[model samples]
Target: MKAAVLRAVGAPLTVEEVDLSGPGPNEVLIRVVASGVCHSDLHVMEGVLPYPLPTVLGHEAAGVVEDVGPGVSALRRGAHVVVAVVPSCGRCRLCLRGRPNLCTAIRGRPGVMADGTRRLRLPGGEEVNHFTMISSFAQFAVVHEAAAVPVREDIPLERACLLGCGLLTGWGAAVNRARVAPGSSCVVLGCGGVGLGIVQGCAVRQAEPIVAVDLWPQRLEVAARLGATHTLLAGQEDVPALVRQLTGGGADYVFDAVGSPQTAALALSCLGRGGTAVLVGVGQRDASLSVPITATVLNERAVLGCDYGSAWPQRDIALLADMYAAGRLKLDELVDRTYPLEGVNEALADLKEGRALRPVILPWGDS
Candidate 1:
């Protein structure tokens, strides 16, 4: 199979033929139909997040099952599925508590399967690391069965790919994590793919005065089309003051979708008394944010960190698929562009330059 492998940090990914092993017990082999080029992948390429070298770096994907290993009764061949970055072991404490997004069994582990074995290898016999245990950048992936959530077949795999990570995280952050109530004023920091999804989720919740913030005008325009009631240019305006003025004393909820210390701080600054600040982006490990303890205590503000929108893949993906199928959710509009496997680097470049939103990688090459 062909895959984009990152052999060095701060370098472009190399697309080349690689070897994949068959599914192990409780694993599924998928013919990856579409994969989304996410900011997380770019972070890995730019060394913002460190990982093992020679690894395939893609986590958002939708595909069809080709084979399933022993003990995998939940899925079968021909089943359409989305690959989840976090694999929830059902027996784990978090999974049992219905918080599978923070599965303790796989958090911060190396990019390997449950048995701690590499399923990908180079022609020279060196093992290629897996990213998030899915490695959706490749033509095929052998992922844990729990990481693959079966979805309705009617939804196109290309658009469904967004549900794997960006859409799920953003949508779930607003709907589940923040629980933005109707008529509540909500502000979403960053107007990328995830930010737009957050806007849409707020729209679905009937949140009033949805504010979208970004440095790019093009993205702000798209956010308006999606659901932003107001758009703010990041560096050009007094964002916190404007938000507080517009919402009659800060927004009820603010989400930092960009995942930087600066954006997180800004999100916190835009919240009203008793309001919650949700951190939705994943920043570098070494990056830290300074919060005002006195203000937080006085204002009774809460700062919350969200992982994958605190979504349970099996339940949330199916619900999202239903919404998309019924036209209640906007999946088609979220896709800004599509690229083939060989064009993965170009897709990443477009995303890094803020020229595209949710570029899907068609592993089968526009077929």
Candidate 2:
């Protein structure tokens, strides 16, 4: 199978004829229809988040089941599915307690299955590493059955790919993690793909006075089109003050989707008393968030970290699919460009330009 493999850090991914393994017990082999080029994948490629070399680097994807493993009963051949990066061991404590996102089985590092073994290989007998436990860059991916959530047949594969990551991360941040109630106010920092989804989620919740802040005017414009009631372009002015002014003296919830310390501080400052600040971006490894100790205690402000929008794949994927089916989620507009696996660099270049919202990768043939 042909895949975009990262041979070295800070280097371009090369298209190579890599060897892929067939499904093992409880695993499913998927013919990847489309994969989203995510910022997290860029981070992996840039060595911001360190991973083993010669790895296939896509995580946000949707495909059809080509084959099922011996013990996998939840999925069938030709079933459409979205790949979830976080795998939940169903019998684990966290999974049993209804928090599958925090399932401890695969916590802290990249490993596959209960035995901590990888499934990918190279043509010359070398083992290839998987990224984010999904590795959807390849034409065929062998993933645990739990990681593949079955979706409806009608949803477009490219749009469904967004639901695997950006959509789930942003929508879950607003609806589930932040719990933005109706009539509440929200300030979303960064109007990129995930930020726009957050804005839409707030709108779907009937949250009033949505404020979106971004340095890019185009993104801010898209934010307004999606759901934001107000847009603030970050120029020389203070963002927190603008958020406060727009929300009538402070927002009930402020989300930092940019993930830098500066944006985190802005989100913290824009919050009203007893308000929550959600950090949705993955910050740099060495960066530290400095918060005023006195102010946090005095105002009763809560700072939260959201991982994959705090979503349970089974429940949230279905809900997002339903929302997409109902025309509530903006999956179609979120797609900026589509590229084949060979055009990975072009897709990524467009992603860094700040013009395109989200770029998807379409694998060729084999389905």
Candidate of highest TM-score? 1
lDDT value for model 1: 0.90
Model 2 agreement with the true structure over 17-109: per-residue lDDT tens digits: 888776877789999999998888888877888888878999998999999989899899999999987878878888888778888775325
lDDT of 1 at 247: 94
lDDT of 1 by residue, 77-161 (tens): 9999998887787788888988999886854367677788899999999999989788988899999888899999998999999
Candidate 2 — what's its lDDT?
0.86
Candidate models: Cα lDDT each: 0.90, 0.86
lDDT, residue 332, candidate 1: 82
- In model 1, the clashing pairs are none
Using all chains and alpha carbons, the TM-scores for the candidates as numbered come to 0.98, 0.96
Q: Can you give the lDDT of residue 137 in candidate 2?
A: 82
Q: Candidate 1 vs. truth: CA RMSD? A: 1.2
Would you list the clashing residue pairs of candidate 2?
none
